[model samples]
Target: MRSCSGWRRFLLCFSLLLIIFHIFSVFEFHPNSVIEIAPKKRNKKSDHLVLGPAAGQGLPNRLQCQGSKALNKSHFLTPSNASNVGDSISFVTVFTIYSTSLDSHADDKSSNLVTVGNVSYTKKERSMAILNVFINFIEVTMPQSNVIILADPESDLSLQRNKVTLYPIQGEYNRDKLMLQRIRSYIAFLNTRLKELAQNPGHTSHYIFTDSDIAVVDDLEHIFQKFPNFHLALTFRNNREQPLNSGFIAVRGTPESILRAKIFLQDVLEVYTLKYTNASRMLGDHLALAWVIKSQPNFDLRRFSKAQAFIEEIDGASVLFLPCATYNWTPPEGAGQFRGMPLDVKVVHFKGSRKRLMLESWNFFSSASDISDMLCLILMSGRTRYDF
Candidate 1:
């Protein structure tokens, strides 16, 4: 009787050990299995500006229903099948910058300064041109759009009017190596803004970094609808030798982007410190952004492939294009007539010496009775009249 009782006790102990081992094995810390654990619950508190599909909530359909059931059975959300169930909502914010230059005539004789009378007039005219372009762009491209523009504190107050929300940065006049440092400093400023938004949870879901020189020339309503997944979006030049122009850049306001930008900016500062070591190199804003983007992972050509249009179509939902000639145009040199040929010229990047001349030409065509007048007449003559 004693031996039988002892045997029963031993069997029971062995059974309990087996159960414990089984449980441990099921919950083992496999790297592959880590991603397969409980579905990452979408932060409900995060801003939901435009509601399409709620995050983590599977669409009610035959396909999704089957998928959900499978997920439930497996007790994990598979990354491959998890995309559709994730958050699709996003918001758009725009960042525009204008920095001062000391060498006004360093570029050439026909540059904007010679024709615009003074730097103040040139800046004013350029601002007006950009404003007009933005107005027209919004009207034609994204009629019902919300945008926040980041600018220098010294920027003209007139540009602050209308739907644009302007956030200003303190101005610094140091035009040497300090300029590069200032650019780096802006990264910290941008990071602060992003952090504030992140903390608020009601801020925009996506952010677009654009140069004040570039304008939105096409419809971009589709961009806001696709969010969180499309990590980075930017334009690259067709020439393989020349690096990507960071004139227009977009990224979802995920933790990854914010963290990535912080790290990238730091790397750029280190590189600048090593190579230039002083204020003489005269590296501009675009070059700094180029360095950051080149060193980063997501901004590579393989990840964020350049679309043919200056307009970036994000996941078949949002589109972003350069705004107007004022923000982006090359002035015709001496005696070089402005040939207003429309290629896929969504954004006009004025790299030449004739800014003031270009501005005059733009104003001429803008008010001329040919294009705008023709458009107005066409609208009036049409059976369905469209209001400007």
Candidate 2:
């Protein structure tokens, strides 16, 4: 009886050992099956503005429906599909830059408006002139998006281009009320367009409104493609903390964005008209936008660094303020000042005295080649000529 009992116990022990070995073998073959791994910890000091898994990737309820689904799918919200989703991925300009230069021998002497003292252009002439230059450059560059020009009413600057649209203002604009008046006009125009675009289902939902003084020497589609999440994209001339550069403004077609822009426009009007109503005193929509950005915290604004724009490839493009010299280059503002070698300056913004001589400045600093020539000429000319 004892031998039989020992035999049964031995068999049971053997079976238990076999079960343990089988379990160990299974784990050896498939080690990760039973292991639950937690995701890596996100760094606090990371520069990237992690926009979260894009639009439709199990995002929260609010983001899922905010006209971002189309953007989520392709990650490229441009003109072709921008309208379908109520977005704007195109370029726009108000083109109301009236030259205050009183130079008789100006480079842009073909147009009376460009000459000193005769600073008035018929609406048609101004529109035609602006489009003539703008279209030439964009045509050469493929993937040319649509361009919208908002001008004064009497100056019904109408011309038909494959991608150009002109809208005339109905009200009598006070040309003397320069910056403030221009801001009001632009705000009104932008608001109207936003509403129209929102109602329509076949146009883009983003618009890059640049000043007439802005010169584009290279393709700017890359600049537009940089920031997909920002409600507004602009550069700062003076203050980086609160960038209010209205000269180059990129507005998104979202309602929340337009509302903020409206608030900013009203603020600019108040500042320029109520308190500082001096036309010559340089007030603009940029300051108003900056003020709103400072006062309000809800805006998803992106202000780029002046230096990053010139760099060929930016590492963390999410925080790109603007293309600085590349997208919006101003000569006196150190854009073409790098070792006397101008980088690939795409857009030359004629601000300050530069605005008065747009053609001269543009010709001198249109591209890296032009800038190089300019530098060579400057070196050849005596220091006294440029000093004072």
Candidate 3:
């Protein structure tokens, strides 16, 4: 009788704990039948007033059906089926950085500095340190993946063979509106790749477009396999006002997919080219994405409900809407209060004030060591949390 009572008590306590954590972020999603779009067109101030800190500050960078089963750990959401990524994958990013040097290697250029949480460091050193975390993390976690970097011609990123490729963005862009320019450059690169790969009928590529300030912690390539039918995989937040973020986009490439993507991008570009309106002003890519979708002729709000939350058929291709908390995980609070996150998290975006957390997270999650990054770590985390 005593043993049974003890077991009952433990089971009851465990059940309560699970219920509590489940409320935080769970995966029981049934997306709405009628998919809605982002609302960037309705609100754009000519003065370029943004919701949060300005774009250059960082220069970067969901639930199932509700009532029926209630999103739980039961059988966490899976994409399609497991398969080798093979040679079909490439990770693309837009990272604008200057020549970087570390401690004592400083020169006159080093005087222009950027600090990460009170730590004195050159802007380039800090940017490189953050970039190293992504580069090294990708090298380890997704060894088969290839990388493409889009940056200013002036920014020199010493490269290696077929693993990493650099495509320089040549021309002048207003520093005040750099984010808009960055997005334009990124889409241009995609267009260029589509043109180059048009003749390669034997192969279909999978491209993961991300911001440089992001570190992919999981084998994100699996997304293409899991959600095989999607042409564009995007991340969205629960917030209705700014629901979609383009920091992590996975393109499941096919000939049709390429054409559809080009068409969609063409419309996004129109927002910038139309000089009369403040096109990609405050919101940049996120705004352009939402506005374009809403303006599309086929966009019918009546079609989306919740049963089909993640995947949507829009434009000419299927766009998979992934939850931001998991794929593009950003710390809700500062690093000091952050312990760690579940390994289920595939990517992390260090935006705005949270850019400082990159080094702290890299040390905790990645095995590769860099004396340069470690040196900068001395100033950051008071308590590092790990959700493993």
Candidate 4:
């Protein structure tokens, strides 16, 4: 009789487990995927950061993916067929991740290069993990776009994907030396693309340069179209001391636009390559940018409205200035000052120690096959709202 009772208890427990699994399976989570919904309602504090764009926000050209079909193979340009002689692409997103760090001594064994297959959520503090999640999210969502990585010399990420192109960033590794090298890499990469555009006048596409720590929360192909005639787009912060953040920048391929962007970058390259050395660490990139913006062929402020973006023109380059709030959502700066991810946020710059939050977000979104409504995420468990 005791043994029979034991068997009954075991069966009851198993049934309860199955019932619990059934309850949460409605969220369309991957099998064995871990989810931790809060017992309480959706935290209003964190809910400040929303997904997608809000109406009447002056974001005229937003992501319109409703009836439109994804780009066909002919339009999706890759490096393999990029030189098709008159091939045109919508835009290209570039990411730079290297084996060296701001501090170089540690990189002899450690690496920062990451790809889709090697990503793991457990290592939230790691740079590789941050970039891994970024690439994974991009590979899944941005199928219509071409992606490239200005890679470090020692990378071994053999991620066999057509959308991804790997270019080299080779040289000696050090703190100051690497900074100068990276600037040159950026110049070379952009110049090559410009050369291609010049060679084949039809080969035109805007290039969006991004830091590795940024995560794509939504589609970003429409960003270039939002601000028309912008040869260059730079996101800035409200703080005056450090006004410019080079983490995200968009450059157009027109001759005038390229000329302006080239001027700015060459000025920057000269600053790092000339001034800031390990022995004399004087001019940093941010300070250099602050100084560069004030140099010859000065950028004349055309417009500065909060609703829209601030526009500047350098001999008709049409440089557009966007706030960090709507675009690169960081913590406690622009949009970071808010509660949840805002609807206008295209990407979140996962800098400092905030990568943990990034992983949590990715897990939440990727757990579900489709999350059309934000309310679906809120009504996750028995009408209880959840937040990261």
Candidate 5:
């Protein structure tokens, strides 16, 4: 009887050990393997959290995809932490190209020695070259995307890229008009398109309208994901509640957002043509948008305080606010200044003489140095040459 009891106890111990081994095997951890937990399904009504960035702060434009070895998994905002983090955000950038004149004035200066992609471009061509670099950089950084270029009837803008689509502006807006009129024309074209998109929201969910002089130095996918709930997102010139910068405005694919853009464009058009307002102030496009946003009903207006629109703000419920500096850094004062790593600068705007200097530098450097180097070079050159 004692020998039988001992054998039974031994058998039971072996079975328990086997069961424990199988349970441990299910969660087996390998030193060299990476485990990417699939995101769980979220409720649809939780869309309100998508309105703003989670505690807006200084975040980089290019976020590493999941399963990366370098970055900490906790550093990134997951679907559990944020509403739209896991959602595949979609956006289209609208670029308006009027004439290739780099500066506001028309000049007979021949093309300079500057060459990009091994193609020699004139000073006028260099203006277009700046645009070429901007577009090429955008395409390279954000692949599998859409870029719509609105070219004047007289302006011959050719972009032979897979994702880029070109549309000629039907307006007879003279290219020789003052820079403000050119801006008015551009906004008109943008508004008309926005109205069309608003009429049919099935094509895309978001749209970004920017000037040709701007270069996107970093990946913008993360930036677009920041303001998922906002119908429209604008960057401010200095502080929140101030005039907005129309150069980098983003809008959701909703009818109301598109209508507000239409109203804003109409106001700008009237200011230049019939309204007889201060052309200088209205042409900025910032004031016009502010006016529209103020007059229009509540439409989820969110503005970036510096660059990462409302990303660092603690109150996620606030629809309108400012972004950080990394969104866009320009040479002109009152535009956000840059004092960090070049890798941190998201977009570089070549304002006034900065554009000319950048065009000239392209001759020496194949492309704009990393955002920091390019910004430093522009600032240093401006200080030494123009006494800025």
Candidate 6:
């Protein structure tokens, strides 16, 4: 009986040990099997705690979280005890272009008459010469900030003191070729300049390209601040959906970003060279750019956000419209018949022959009447404020 009781007690002890071992095996923490826990939401005052399994020694925190709701949970899973970082630094730059001679049309021809603000001129014109005086109007109306001008190096015009930086490019007057290609060449040149800046580690976060004909009616500092991650920004041309006319562009000066752009340009050049011997067929820079962005791995072009129409503020600082009519404003055909009548416009871009003729009519009016009619038309549009 003593032997039987001792054996039974030993068996009970062994069974208990086996059960405990099984329980431990089920709950054991395996490096490979470790599951990520969902973050728990907390109040603003609560300490932001990040929870995660400790990674290898000296590894930076790599906790994956999804959605805004997850971010709101306050808990961040990090490998290390490193503090959570905030947004990265950002900056913006602008460029403009201008010409003294209204006779020297964008089409590379000389015309006798140019009109602005209701005044007309028959002889050679100066900065003061006019009819549809749009450029001068913009300079007076728009925000006075960091404005850079790309122009003919030989042209003599007294730019506002320290307000404009004069950068020159070789003028191409050829209209037979694709206008898009000429524009691309200019953009490529701008990119080269930006790449130089990118090489310096201490480069600004963003660079903006704007046509000399454009006007900034409001402050643009906030646009840069709000969307720091966007690779580019521009006013979408109504005629073409594709982002083109570098009338405006925002670029982040990084080697990777510029390299990607170079690759895109090369791809476009190669494709066009093979398909078309004429310049007109090659006039698809905007389309080509969109294609490269869509096709290339890791190249992001959807990062663009269109500027809203007529609004003064977007998120924070004053938003600037690339003056629709007066600055880069193109008047519709038959705009001249409505002479002296209020035509709504901010920036007027003389894009085609008809629009240029309309601008020429403005030169016929007296200086005072010219300013008054322009202001009245712009305000009558009801979307813009004419403080200038």
Name the TM-score of candidate 1: 0.47
TM-score of each: 0.47, 0.53, 0.63, 0.60, 0.55, 0.44
Pairs of residues at least 3 apart in sequence or in different chains that clash in candidate 4: 47-340, 48-339, 48-340, 49-339, 49-340, 49-341, 50-341, 50-342, 52-343, 332-336
Candidate with better TM-score, 1 vs 4: 4
Of candidate 3, the 10-residue stretch with the lowest lDDT total is 47-56
lDDT of each residue in 112-149, candidate 6, tens digit only = 44443444444334232321133443334332333444
Which lDDT values do the candidates have, in the order given? 0.41, 0.48, 0.58, 0.53, 0.48, 0.38
5 versus 6: better TM-score goes to: 5
Task: Give the clash count for each candidate.
Answer: 17, 14, 28, 10, 18, 39
lDDT of 3 by residue, 1-388 (tens): 9999999999999999999877543433524422333234322212111121111111111212122221222222222332354646888887765443244355457456554334555655666667776787677557677788877787666555558888787743445566576667766877776777775566777788888777665566567767778878777765544567778877777766766766666676676456313544446667767666666676654433221336777766788878776688665432123323322456767665445566655653334343222212311321222111
Q: Kindly state the number of residue pairs that clash in model 5.
A: 18
What order do candidates take by lDDT, descending?
A: 3, 4, 2, 5, 1, 6
Instruction: After superposing candidate 1 on the true structure, give the runs of residues whose Cα lies further than 4 Å from its correct spot.
Output: 1-140, 146-160, 171-174, 177-182, 203-205, 223-228, 239-241, 276-345, 352-354, 357-365, 368-388
Give candidate 1's error at residue 378 in angstroms.
22
Q: What lDDT does model 5 reach?
A: 0.48
TM-score of 3: 0.63
lDDT of 1 by residue, 184-253 (tens): 5446555875778677764444555554433344333344453324545545543333244445555556
What local lDDT does model 6 show for residue 28? Answer: 85
Instruction: Locate the minimum summed-lDDT window of 10 residues in model 4.
Output: 65-74
Model 1 residue 223 distance off true place after TM-score fit, in angstroms: 4.4
lDDT (10s digit) by residue, model 2, range 1-388: 9999999999999999999999999889999856444122221222111122221224331112222122222132233433232233566676442443323344355443333223344433443454555654444332455677776655534356887777766543545555565676667877786677678745455667777656555555555465555555655543554455667766666665555556555665675555455532355455554554455454333433334532111121121256454466554422122222133545655454433234333334344333333323222221111100
- Which runs in model 2 stand beyond 4 Å of their true positions? 1-88, 96-131, 156-160, 238-243, 284-290, 293-320, 333-344, 352-388
TM-score of 4: 0.60
lDDT (Cα, tens digit) per residue for candidate 5, span 145-230: 45766655566555576666676655544433433554555566557766676566565545666766676655655654555555
